[model samples]
Target chain A: MPNPDAGGHWGEFGGRFVPEALIAALDELEAAHTAALADPAFMSELDALGREYGNLPSPLYLAERLSEEAGVEVWLKREDLNHTGAHKIRNVLGQALLTRRMGKTRIIAETGAGQHGVASATAAAYFGLECTVYMGEEDTRRQALNVARMRLLGAEVVPVTTGSRTLKDAMNEALREWVASVEHTHYLIGSVGGPHPFPMLVRDYCRGIGDEARAQFLERTGALPDVVAACVGGGSNAMGIFTAFLDDASVKLYGFEAGGDGYGTGRHAATITAGQIGVLHGARTFVLQDEDGQTIESHSISAGLDYPGVGPEHAHLAASGRAAYEPVDDAEAMAALEKLARTEGIICAIESAHGLAGALRLAKSLEPGARVLVNLSGRGDKDMGNVVEYFDFADRKGQQG
Target chain B: MRAEAAFATTRAEGRAALVGYLPAGFPTLADSIKAVDIMIDHGADLIELGLPYSDPVMDGPAIQRAADQALAAGFRTRQVFEVTEAVAGRVPILVMTYWNLVERYGVDRFARDFKAAGGAGLITPDLIPDEAGEWIAASDEHDLDRVFLVAPSSTEERIASTVAACRGFVYAQSVMGVTGARAATSAAAPELVRRTRAHTDLPVGVGLGVRSGDQAAEIAAYGDAVIVGSAIVNCYLDSEDVPAGHQRLAALTADLAAGVRR
Candidate 1:
């Protein structure tokens, strides 16, 4: 709930574990973040950008069909309706603003599902700043539409072809690029995962989701929801919605991790559910590592939730028992996605579907009238290709729609 | 040969020490040990045996390629000590690795096993002084040297704190980038070394981008040691066969040694 101490230790999880060359830059970023938070002009500018550009205060819509199915009230915080069709735009806009404050002209980022990359590219285009995004070669293929979207937004997308060819490798490549260009380029980390200020910084930027949702839910129902749920990868969206409810002990929070095949199969990205404590991508957190501390490649049908490590704050939250995390396997998440599309006519990202699956399961255990809010983190338009392949839509009846 | 003694020996000869690096299982574990032997036999004053990690964010293309091959070939953390113990009698051996490997290996346990294996210490690229409390305690308890890095971007206070935690020597990163050979050495190296010297009497070794004898000689003029990695690793990677890698590694070591002595 509080900011990390001087050395960025969030109960011994988040610290700057990076090359000496990057220490100065991280320190500068931390200082700038501290300064910007206190500056009224900066805050006002960000708020205006959120309203005019990012479609701030995304709608909180009641899903009557989902509620009836779960025998409980269900509401969807529609972050999918935001600019760039994901929660990532909030963090990108915040970081892009900081990049300007730091007097940097170029920004670089790493992406998994390409939502973050596209959001960053969009922000860069708005600000007329140079942008480059590093995505794993595999993800570039899986999310080719998002890749093209980034390029069309005037950002160069570099395909990282290292170590598992996924989000982790893209981050590794971004760090490598940042090391050489630290003086003039800001590494606009897209998640609440990396070193020191990143986990805290990105979380703060995206916390608007929870802030607006909390107010709207309270205003509508005269009380908070019984549960809040979101998918956890690097955990930004989950953190974005969870932070506001941390103090409301009655409101239980759940983070659903991508369980590719299942927990037993060893081919999952369920870091908190099945992983051990270790360091990855600059933060000491729950990591899926081999016996010798080598990072094991994580598998997930949802590219956004396929990372082998979760955010440090989420690790701390899990360790402290403030929130519970569970694994939602590929089949369960896909089924939930199908249900949402059929019931509400809302096709959501596969990553968000994990949270939907977890929420549906949790809702069954609660009192019949208990309310649950799910963070729909992104739209499914970019995932149309993957969805088509998975469901084999061409073979299904009424495929024309 | 302990770290201080190794540097002292070269200091007595009025020359900088030549510090050479190679991953522990590149090519193969046996060939990597053989390569180290060839390096020492030729003229490497010290050895920094690399433990190829999965996410080597600080490595350049050459080292990344070799590390990838090493990891793919099933190289693990324990084999680093095997190579160190094999070559420790020839020169002081410092295991260069990321912090996660040591943390996962257990800090006290790693220090104990490494010390028992006749290894000198660690050169952790990611373990900056701010997060080095456990490592500092372990190294001290085990009487092992700890080498921390200083960079061109390091503030004066950071350099001082980094050197203060170091036991063997201070590593000065020549450039603001990952490790690889460059056409020219950094223009910032000399100033960084001078700043680091103001904090501690620890010998400063300049690393990153030094490949040729000319570059080695240039760094030797100011630095206490000249550290090279990618070029030496490239010797094995670019060679047609393992024996030829040994030949190329030995020749390069001798050239670097001559440059330091010049």
Candidate 2:
């Protein structure tokens, strides 16, 4: 994994910039986490749960059909094949273990993709903790199935209507809730973002994606993959897979952010590409902001990639030149999503489609045999409604040929 | 009209300093400006003019809703300067905001504008001293006060660092929650105030969960300045109309101000 600077910085990007009310809670969380890290019982229990509950070692597969189209040895890290159909399960389960450790019986979370919400609900159900999820009203409307899924899993889902009503707002509500309910609740942050120890703590739990990918890829390819790529919102999976390759100088990493329309159109969540360095939601990172230092509303077709800010570690990686980021426009991402399903029978989430789109762009310059691995972050089930409406699939299908 | 001067003046009067907060464009910029003047007339010694950013994580629903309305109404950062410039010198004013709004607006330029507009200092809810080397240096250059927060959870080392970095008074939290009024005063406030005073002779201001005069008086016993945010905003939030909100707010400010008198 890439070495973080002291005090939770990825460089100058990550630090705990939160209100006074949250500091004590963050300190308690950090102290508890530090002890848990050294405690073998905690590790064993977490590992056991990961194996039995999350179905760890999500397979690494070579996409023969995708390779031919891309003209590179394309591979897929099957995070989609995990328990929740995304990499989010890894994080929430770990946090659930920590919640139990801290003796916090209530759990709260913020979600954009609904993957994280579903994962949090799953963990809460497993542990029998009271679960409440804050989701953007727009996201709830787009990803209604996930909202139902969360409710089915025994979580109360709150639709936040404030400020563009997306991931950023949901996160803001979650932080507000955590501040008020810190005495009895644990805020299970879904990404490798937020303030001190959370960014680091989440990274610790989430590194398994990269760790498994590294071992699996090395065994199959006899060397590290030439490139590793994943879609970045808060950058949990991207950082998860990228960490395993951070120390390896030769293996390049890429994080593809959602360009909702395009960068120039001001409707996108391309924070690393279009954002300036600043603080948002507890951590100092790259954020989309107006010249006046106020955060701007970010847009994305994929709710998962619709955040105004990205993880601090991603900010540090970009600053340090360890990883590069690119923006994949909404149209381009959808096209790749369709292409991947048609070519390889893998209906990946639109979030993962951004990575596939970027990889396709990357393939045009590389030789046919060169290896590329993409974190297929999730399945397309929750996004079907959005996809259908966005593409006008039903209307088009209803029309006569 | 520096923050320290306001606290010192209040101490001389045998009362806890009454710090009032109003988000820059709540209801409207003109009304908010007029409202703060009324608050000052009633008894507010210091004003924390809130810059309404899109995500106000530290704020409660009342403040958050107000901020959302303000931002949605196109309350720009420059408008904060307008509010400060119009209301400055009447009372010591600090722009209470998150760091990103200041950073996205260049730190050097932000401090310069705030200072030029007669802003006494910043009460940054998010920016801590350790990560604030740039802000510290910039504030020093601009001769603006830097008010950092000290929570009950603050470690002794963290307290020392915050006290050293702060140029004005240290902002102490009365509770472990976002800004809002509560039924009872925080049990943790007195000890936190005593703990902070041990480190520095700088006046410690306690904020969060303070609403009524009874609550304010209890906190004022230990806190140098009792900061009221959500309670003040709730006047606007719960009122039938803007004018009523402003009127109720003025009355409440006076009530709280009287309670601060020893």
Candidate 3:
């Protein structure tokens, strides 16, 4: 197991590779991050915000039904219960506070499924700063409800039409906007990807989940779980939980990637499970790219899990064998979603179902008493349409002809 | 102001002649030409006619928007050559561009047509030095000065190698970042100029974030020539019409040139 304060370089996976236009912004972020690490005043400010605004220290609930079904003891760290209904608010609040400290007046963010946009808008509203979000035209059309949510939250949503019309296009649009407004606007990147300080900073803010979970788990179970499971999209949620348990050699960490159809079909966003080491976005990470280094289109039933690249820190974790990555196909994840909805009445997002599915499979292979902790990354409220459509539940109920 | 004599003199000066940059087809090609004429009129010595690419990574938003507008108006490689040819060697023209447009245009034909159009130099902002040797040789055959940029992050050995292969004055990026106009010049520009001077006697002109007359004057104290780009492009954005834009630019350049001379 590696040390926690290891400068966010999982091994050689995380480093800054941004355009020259962003050097100043990145440098300022790095400097502020360094200062915040040592300054108790900055730390306490974030702590207060987490408690008052973000509803920090979310509970680690023992999933008695899930454990009984899987024949293993299972627990969940409920990050989906956060203020923004996902883990994204944790990072956004921290970054928004830092933006105020830097004297910046504007905030810009790019979103795929609009979770990050909602979180960023929430932060901007709290801080009284102007906010703008760039989302791909395709995503905007598919996630119309989230777009309306952002608008209602007082953040302008600009639809990007370039590239593949997905998260990649939104990112390119955001980069263009950042280059133009580099002076007074801070780009609030959503996940543990992009350049150096971003992955490090987002991970630092979200690490509270793992820290609290570790202490709570010890108090309840008398020891850490044998395995920790979390779904890896941009890997923020997984890294947040894994960071605290990285040094616990007895605990095995598993990250489940979206295997759209399956790794064999080659249409998945399972970068760690199916990709080679390469560069994308800004960091050197495992990416689904061709020989010429062009990014390939990825597929997933879940829009949030359709990105072609994973966080650089996840790449490092995969490389060092500190973490094991497995892919959960569309069918399997969908099944897990239904299983949780029926068993526990907790409708989990299709993305979070990847972790749920992985936990079930791992439980089947392990001793009946072995404990597993799954980071239930988000709720299924945003994904109800996809679940209903994929399962044809309304048609079976005779609600549709 | 003929390009042949300017190239010959530039070679004799033991330094690359300064090629001032102004976005082509910006405001309008008609007024863009006047801005070019104004640069040549005020001892610009050489000129870089920027053929705006859709994705200009090395450029700031102001220049990027200018390029986007130029592109939106159907500004292609052939139009860039036609515009330069219209100048008729009043000053040497270098087509600064992204490689994708050049690849689409066919590099050999693009090189030949560019030189035949009274152009005397070429600068590819995105070309890495390791991959530029073949193009450098091709440009030499066509008798075009190949300009290159040196940054703060470039290693000393890489700088020497690139400078030795380079034909025109080395473009000294004043800051560690991309092309933009700033309220003030970068504090690092002086040290960067000093470091560039140590390796090659090529007249180093500092660019990126140079916006005002006072900053140009300060840079001119150390640099052999000061390169102002984003400021001039932003001036075009400020005006409603092309001729009005060119008139504004001419006045601004004259003031900046005077400060540089002082």
Candidate 4:
């Protein structure tokens, strides 16, 4: 329940841990964002773009078959149905509008799953601004479709092969790019993470997901669900959906982190669950780092969830006991992903599957008729190739032979 | 402070000090040690030994590459001590690091171990004054100098506060960007120095995009010291032969040292 200080500290967890050169740029961004939100003309423009371009008001659907199988009603806030097939568009579109407000013409972003990059590219195309994306080389290979999607949208993609060649390193490279190019460029961060204004800004833009789902759930059930769940990577969708329920004491927030091989293996990205609180990517939050404070590599089968750090707001919420976090392993997430596709016929991204898996478990503990809401943050189409490779569908043969 | 001593000596000589940088554990740990020695022997009055990190947001491609190579070669926090021990008594050595390393290594422990290794201080590019409670307290406990950076975009209030927090000379970034060598000196460098100077009687060192001797000389004319990193890192990174790179590093340091005298 603790709010961030005026200087952007989420109770010693979130501060501008950047060079002095970037203070001016972050100040400019924070000021412009505040001004834009306060202006009716700007807010209306952003809302119009959200409706026209991003296909806002993402539907909330009751997964009937899933409900029957689990003996509990499960509602899905379908962020997957957004324009870029993910919740990432909400942040990008808002920041893209902010870029114009700041009188900048260039937009840069860092991506791991490439969902955010594609979203940023889509916004840039709409706004007629030049776009560039920095993706870790490993992520580029893992999320090839999203890379091509960004490129096809006319955004230049730079593959960062530094450090672990993952999301953390890609963000470092993106910050470097921003420092040199801050005047004419806006770094369109895609998560509820990073330095000030970004985490808050991204959350504000995405709160519409929670707003819509809350209304839809109310109309159908006449009450809020007992539990609301979402996967946490850099944790945009989770923050988005959780924002609406912050004041509702009965709505228990559950954030599922990626437990790649499980906590014992030290290979997971379950930062809040198993890692220590430290600064990374400008935010002081739970991070997987070495004894020397160097960030350790994080592994996740779901590219979107393969990050070493969590958002600072989530850290504050966790500290206040307003939210509880759990880790869902890769195998569990994949099982839930396959199950959702089979039962609901609505494929879920591997990242969102973590939440689905957690929901399934939470439902068993609750009353049989209890309701649970999950944020389906992205579509599964981009993950089909990885799923096939992971389950070895290409190698599986019919037993009849 | 050792940095103050070096600056005093240089000022007495009627010249701005040549501040050199080299990433610890670069090329190889052993070669990195030799490189630092070469720089100090050639002309550097102050040494900024980079503690190689996994994510260096403030660094450009060259320094990042050097750090990546160092880290790839099994570098860790202990390696910083090793390099510092090897280069002790040559010049006032300041470990240029991002804040995470200190936080991870435990600020008190890092300061103690560094002081034990005869290190002068730390130049934290990321840790600013307002959020620098731990570093400031640790430095005081260890009696070690703590350097802070100021930029062209720094407000008067910021410059004043940053200078107030600094023990050594104020690091006045030449531009509003990360570390790298530039084709020409930033137009904002001299003005940034002037602004920081207006805030404090403390010496001001200019950095960010300063590459060649010509650029160093221009910065030296107004600034108290010229801190160069990516340019020195570039020497070893681009050289086909590391020994030649070592020679080039010394030669470059000598050239910059001469420029500071102009």
Give the number of the best model, judged by lDDT: 1
The residue ranges of model 4 lying beyond 4 angstroms of the native Cα positions read: A1-3, A395-401
Fnat for each model: 0.91, 0.82, 0.01, 0.86
Rank by DockQ (best first) = 1, 4, 2, 3
How well is each residue in A1-401 modelled by candidate 3, as lDDT tens digits? 23223333556666644443355477788888778867899899998899888888788998888788889998988887888787777899889988998899999998999888989998999999999999989999989999999999999999976657788768767876786677799999988888777888888888888899999999998999999999988899898899999889999999999999987998898988875775566666887765424457889987888888888888888888999999999999999989888888888778889988988988899998899999988888889778778987665554657
lDDT of 3 by residue, B45-154 (tens): 66778887654556776787787687667665677887788765666677777654564566777888887887877776655454455577778788777767766655
Of 1 and 4, the candidate ranking higher by TM-score: 1
Clashing pairs in 3: B16-B169
Instruction: Give me the candidate number with maximum DockQ.
Output: 1
**Candidate number achieving the greatest TM-score relative to the actual structure:** 1
What's model 3's TM-score? 0.70
DockQ of each: 0.90, 0.71, 0.08, 0.80
Backbone clashes counted, model 3: 1
lDDT tens per residue, model 2, B43-110? 99999999888788888888888887888788898899999998999789999988888888889999
TM-score of 1: 0.98
The order by descending lDDT is 1, 4, 2, 3
lDDT measured at residue A276 in model 3 versus the true structure, 0 to 100 = 73
Q: Which portions of model 1 miss their true places by more than 4 Å?
A: A395-401
State the DockQ, from 0 to 1, for candidate 1: 0.90
Worst 10 residues of 2 chain B by lDDT: B173-182
